[model samples]
Target: MSSIIPGTQNALTAWQPFNGARLSVTSKTSGVSSSLPNSLQVQIPKVVSGPIGFENTGYWGIKVQSGWTYQGSFYAKSTSFSESVVVSLKSTRGTVFASKAVMGISTSWTKFTFEFQPSASADTDENVFNVAVDGKAAAGQTIFFSMFSLFPPTFRGRENGMRIDLAEALAATQPSIWRFGISVATRWKWNETIGRLEDRPGRPNTDGLGLLEYLNWVEDLGAEPILGVWDGISTANYSDLSTWTVVPEADLQPYVDDVLNELEFIVGDAKTTEGGKLRASLGRTEPYALKYIEIGNEDQFQPESYAAYRWNAFVTAIGAKYPDFEFIATTLPSTALTPAYQRIDFHMYNSPSWFTANAFMFDDYPRNGTKWFIGEYAVTSTNDTNTLGDIPSGRLPYPTLQGSAAEAAFMTGMERNSDVVFASAYAPSFQHIRNYQWTPDIMTYDASRVVKSTSYYVQQLFSTNRGTHVLDTTPVSSNDTAPLFWVASYNNETDVVFLKVSNTGSQDLVANIFLGFTATDFATATAISTPALSPISGLFNVSNTLEEPELIIPVATSFALPFSDRFNYTFPATSVTVIALQSTTALEV
Candidate 1:
């Protein structure tokens, strides 16, 4: 049983990004230092002396902050083959962060990457970057390098908000039913040289994240694992994408059966040589959960074949055995809704401009018949450094904040229509520190540490505080001129009412909130705010380097508490505020 405290106004305050932080890029060599070829690229000084190495002596680095896998890639080619090359990340204090050695082949360009988890003793910190070619280089053989990256392995409770306690709390609230998921064609990369860390063959991939890794990641995020099946043919290059479907069902069966069998073991029917299961049940100590199976990722390119080759087979075999779970297809026959499938899926990266022009884009789609999920999305202007591409509009004055606000607004829409928009998440949630393709992401990490963007805080605000009841907010005319103003209240079972007020205009406005409630046990109020008109510039290239990140955070302040039903509040122009009201109805008095 829950009820909202009607019309309550609490004087709000402010909160900012971490104040003492800064991020800067400094060159270690005595020679010239320049910017790299791409937008996110930063240049390191060319070292050409004693050891004849291309080692990153002084640059940013990150740690394997909890996870079993790390992934990153960079291109390097030399005039001579057979030169010794080691791509590594080390701490300023000389501790080895993480590294992968690449054996120089021919004069042709080669991309080297490593996937690893922290050693038992590994600890995370800032100042991490790509450490490349740590040995002697041939006198006349120069090497070029770009697109260096790293992805740590997934572990239980390691995701941003999927802590065990948090998951349990969500379950306790029981707002929605749990669903299992998986991917078929998406994120199912093959570890061709699956044996060694360095020797494993690598290339551009269609799979967003490896299939096993994606399931593990989703489970860690507290979402039921929805497996996406692939046409599974291991490749040393993206050019050799699997043709199991393009050819014939006879050709696809062997690959399909093998993967399905392997998956069974990962999901608990089969056992691992490591002697332990992959995941635990909800709150289990082991921390992996799998409940859904998806046929393929974005199979629209080969819909007919995909349906016959993978989807049909999946429905026949796995579906027969696990009829209880839901099946999600990327697209239906023609209509927006279909009862044949449990849910419909869409992938959106149509530039931030697309969202700005059509914020209610999803509303145009019919929801009376089926459920939908924006499986993968991002507001990035560019995709993987491709410039001839669509440049997204809605660019923020600040690059760091641009993607954040847009994403939050988009998410609010999803939440408002959860009946149809079942799930929404940003695609390519990560980027290799220096190998970024997109303009902005929620969180970024190198081999050493993680950094939060303006978007991260926004997501944290809504996610950390789940609202149980939605209040009815109505608009009214005011004599006092100000920017657009709107306020809504949410009452969580936690005995707190969260009042969120937004002033999108340039003029400051005085706001008065009137509270009507059943009880009166008043408590303190707090706020998280983002102020407008900062003296700092909002350029996309602007970063709070190790020397100065304060350019990004919100400032914090407090106000005296009042146990009054009617109160006055000031709305700062172009700011976001979260005001919590004390519960007057749940008092002992």
Candidate 2:
């Protein structure tokens, strides 16, 4: 929680005037620079009934917890006499949760910092980070403020770290990898997001999601990092973001050099490499366990420049140095090169029906070749019925039973082809309920509460129960899969058999699974199904929203794996289920 002030085009539009305080934005000097030019200027009115200043309802709300220290700092300059200023965290109704006062602030430009510990937590997130002054004492005076920030206790107590509650929720998922920056708007600017927060030019200290912080995040989650580097190409006619700028081949070396420097900082020896030394100076003596460096994101939009040399230029340059790092290409690898690519990343965002119908899409691929990573996949539409085939209509707002079930079926297909499909992740993982452009995100949150979607539970069930090898079954196959799809896997490490099933149609199916290997003593079944909480029609299409986050959550019960080779399970009309049974022996593949 760095500065409550948002960098919205570096404007003062985020502040709300309070108690007759006239507020205006200015392009000023001293504490300001050209990068972030606009600063908040407050003009105090004549003596009034209460204090006069500005308030920021951060990201729609500010969450305050009891006995938690809120650290804040800001720069200010006064046109006339030195005046006292009051900074506080409180509800909009004027109930102060925490308060601090700076006595007789200097008239010349100076920095002020404060630490506030609230005795009581706020009832709701309808609060504000506020600043004010005595209207009577500072009557008719003008003041300028810049570079403001406030933060609660950080995740893992890392200075300027991630939000704790969000981090904890992600940890529970047992994530295997975290994709850092995938789009052009958020191209991984390695140079701008590292070292001391203060030294990072243009960005405020609250801008702490730097490269180091990202690596620390990967470390904390016990996951590998997929670093996405910019390859000088933007989405066609996307926006005014770049005027569709594509860096010339002559100028591509600097970008290639930037990628090498980034890798050096991450995995190079602290004593031998310049980038590594810089990292060591920042107190990261040990190298981060990073290996995958993805070149660009979906660069195929402009195939001419990308395939011609852009991809190979980076691959050739970096591969010569760090040959061990596996490269994942967002675009199709050049066929001319030997061993086309180590891994390829592909994305898909379509309808739920499309996902279920195409569940076996990967099964047709040749088994022995370049591995694949489905970096992004999601069910975004009601159907492909829109007038424009591209503009999907009646999109899902949250993960519905039908959508999640469809995703599960697709997962089962991937698990069946696990050797070729190395990994897959849902696209647009998180969203804030207050404002969002994308729908059906895996996790949704607000200022204070987090809501896991039905899709989230599906992901957790599969990820937590992923086994060592796909197990072979006997008798009737579970792949009568138009309505029901399944895949059985054996975890050699734990001696457990994980059977995942997904029923995607209106009618339920009774699966009688007969394994060649003997079953273990007991078993448990976990499922995300149509909600029984209330009688809602069209159960399959039912979804979970912020108002009812737990409406369609996974339910678990003590079930049993048959003493012999067969155990029966009745798959619900629209649901995804996982059964884990202890098994000492597995059938041969």
Candidate 3:
């Protein structure tokens, strides 16, 4: 288990391959084994005068703290009898803190253990763990190595684990739910991700983010998982985009079976079903955390007739077995609503101006149909001048303060109408910087560091400070050109009122907040503001920026007239402000 809170490190794990590990070899030739699976074979043609170092490429964001010991080990075998290998943890500058020598290496696998405690506190994201050959080796002498595991006390101290710093950063956000397997929806098959890690086929662009790992991440975060099952649709032609369609019934039935079994594996316990039994073998005896099972990913590309047929078939089959589970349709069904289809997904990727203007997009939406799930949404504005057209081109835009403020404005609308919008999540939630395709990601990170975008802070603010119910608030006066967006929600349990306000204009404006209820006295008021007009550092790009002024910083400038029932505050230009008011008087039951 990780020491960090669960669900926080959703993007920590990656495929552990020799190349991916970024091993640096010197005076020794090393390559992955072809005959022996998961083994790295090293051969020294001639012994060098100095120690031949085989250092890891140092991409694993390992943080070495003073007085903290890290226990690690690896399996090694040498062709020559009684040959020894020296293992040590070293800083990027080649300063060794700890070392261990293993003797009596034979043909069979032998585990070698070592412990390292940094002499001084250092966060060496590019540091390497090295295994150096001390002495000369005969011509063509071979050494086999496998399962090179190193764990620096993880978040919850899970055996094979996550980086603590990254985990801590994510847990701070307090995400309520996680939606997984959406980007790879067309290619992802649930069965391919279960069982042993090595046995599963690798996902394209994703560094081995299997189903079990995803579930464990969600479980760690204490958040629910929304699984996006693959819709049994295949594309026949690449040039002709219209060639994609649902597979034949014979093939579709097997795909449906796979999805059903996946559900069983998730929600079933011991003695429940075959998938459940397999789940038990994987160490989870009880059902894992799963609530919403999305039928497909953006299924609107396929013919409407076939898409409807596929949706009906999947819903009918899954609903029959797990009647309690709620199913989310990828697109609005062409036909009438079915009991199985509890929600419909809505995706939006528009400009910053468009998002701010359409803050109340869902206000007029009919409540007679399926509920709304903002499954994927982000403001797709680019910093590059060439990419300013209707579509994206050139370098993508970093998550700017302007974009985040616009999103915050839109989110206030969503919260005000939370009854209609059941759940929402930002798209491209996790992106490995080296292998990312989309831009303006919520969180971006390289092998060594994780950088939360401005959009992430906005999401975090809303998720952490959510209220029990919406409260109607009327603004005394507002300019139509320089619109001031605000939403108020009350937490009855805590006797606190949360007012989120966004100002998207050049000049500041004063607004009087009217709750329109019984008389109440304000106890204390604090506001968190993200002002877009504030000058930011030039180096503050999407991948290397922190939240300015922090997400929930204090605001000491609010006035309540001595004998009045109103509170007044100045809204800064191009800013997102969240105000929390604690009332002195109690509410009437």
Candidate 4:
């Protein structure tokens, strides 16, 4: 696995008519045109001529850290005599950190370079880069600007890279598998996301998060990619039962070929396939960490018989081609006595109460059938009045502590039933603050900062402290029904016991934990807790001004060995706690 901290690289691109550039011409008569290829043309008809400025033109914002050097360059040409243009980096307050003047401009395209180091650090997204032409012009005088490039040190120091802060935040999650495909899977064509970044057509994804970039991110995070292939089914048509049908085999064959070719591009070697050669040409000689492929996003909408037909066709073709990889069916098999695929996908989105009550949902699932993948699950409670004002009044509630605690309880169930549940991932993993369509996402961010939801911390805690084997533990009292849930596991390699418990009630409860061994068998014990706040509805909601609090901090006096054979701990009301016991002996029972 790679280090959690990423290296450095350049974070800005698309300089010519910069991706999101805004033109500000002081003179109304002066016009700016981006119709030319790889360039922006500014025309001054001599009727009115003055400085023309462009700001906020990058893909997002130019993120600058304190005491870091940023290199900038641009190409410019003028039809008139020598001209001068000033370029500078400034904060939202109009404070120029650094500036430079390109003294001479010729008729021919010329390149100019400048370097600047911000004296102070900008931890926010209020920074921007600007290029301005400040002078009176004669008739027929025009200037052309192209290939404007500015680069700050990135997370790996690679050219055309990702933001360091956001990358680090994602890596910290320690995810086992990175599943890509939300609504994008319906119309996502793999060919459109490859090749040059500038050449890719503008679509709903304006942040430049293409296939290659996503694969690189997955590789950097030490996680395998689970690519979702489009099934040539539209979301609109899937909503109507009358239109529920599968595309003919002849029509679906070409799409299946596209998916297979994509897989070849991902896993094939340089000499084996054309897609592999293309992958090598893109600077990645080795195949990616690709193992699992999903047939479609959610095929549950189709009629069961038709859906089964689609699944069999996809499984037969893709499975025959890439037998080494595992395939996941969107739903259970409809025709086969045994499952046709390796795993079945299930999704759940409900209230907090539902998750807590269903903590043991998979306890009785047959151990012999197809494994299950909880591809999407979350506790979505619609009661947060804090951020409700920001959206429409009827919008759903934000993620709250009650929801997170319930999710914690649900995750403990998953850990206990890991044998049946092979893999799972929370849905809507990322949301850009400005362009988000989903509510209660795990990670929300602007250009400069990332806000981890309370649920995010819950996932981090469980992922980092996962165990190898589940240990049997006594069930909670049948008389007391205050929404208490628990799961116990032991790691033979580490010789440690992980006790995860969640209490979603009003009153504190004392839990008598039986280790089935003597207290002296363990050397030490540490506990961490996420406490629910008062009137629980007022739980902290992640937003712009403030992120989530330190809800997952360690608790010093939560657990104690009151007797030699038993451990006593007081679980706070409406809270989730994990107690890790370091043992000298690896107790099997």
List, in order, the clash count of every candidate structure. Answer: 66, 1, 15, 10
Per-model CA lDDT versus the true structure: 0.45, 0.77, 0.64, 0.65
Is 1 or 3 the stronger prediction by lDDT?
Answer: 3
lDDT of 2 by residue, 203-296 (tens): 4322357889888988998988898888877654532334566889998999899888988998889999998898999999999988888888
Estimate the TM-score of every prediction: 0.56, 0.91, 0.82, 0.81
Q: Predictions ranked by TM-score, top down? A: 2, 3, 4, 1
lDDT-based ranking: 2, 4, 3, 1
lDDT of 3 by residue, 2-46 (tens): 111223332124322221122212213222222124345555555
**Candidate maximizing TM-score:** 2
TM-score of model 4 (CA atoms): 0.81
- lDDT (tens digit, per residue) of candidate 1 on 1-589: 0011111121000100111111122222111112222111122234333332333322233443434455566555544435655555555454665566667545544666556554434453543443443223443344444334444442353422232332342333222223323323233334331222223222233222333444454443455555555553221222334543354776777756655554544544324422124222222234235555556666665566655555666666666655665677765544322235667677666443354334445545675667777776665552333311333443322224444444444555565456677766555444445556554555554444345555445555555555555454433312132233333345546656665544434345677667655324343332223335455422332333323434455444445446466566775544445566657554321
Best by lDDT: 2
> How well is each residue in 1-589 modelled by candidate 4, as lDDT tens digits?
0101111121123222222223222222211222113345555445445555455435466566677777778767766746677787877677777778786787776778888788776655667787766545433466666555577766676555667777787789898988884334336666666765444442446324677887887888888788877775655543355654456656777877888888888888888889899999988889887788887767776645436455666667777888888887776555451335658778877766677777877888777767888888876554433222223344433455567777888888888889889888986777776667776678777666667766776777778777888888766422244477877778889877777777766567897677665545333433333444534323333222225434344444434456667767777765667777766577874
Instruction: Give candidate 1 regions above 4 Å deviation.
Output: 1-223, 231-250, 270-287, 300-310, 332-339, 350-369, 382-399, 446-449, 475-492, 501-533, 537-548, 554-574, 586-589
| Model 3 C-alpha lDDT versus the unseen true structure | 0.64
| Candidate 3 Cα errors over 4 Å, as ranges | 1-38, 60-62, 67-73, 109-115, 137-139, 183-186, 189-209, 234-246, 303-308, 336-340, 382-391, 394-397, 432-435, 475-482, 518-564, 585-589
Task: Report the lDDT of model 1 for residue 61.
Answer: 39
Q: Per the 3 Å backbone cut-off, how many clashing residue pairs does candidate 1 have?
A: 66
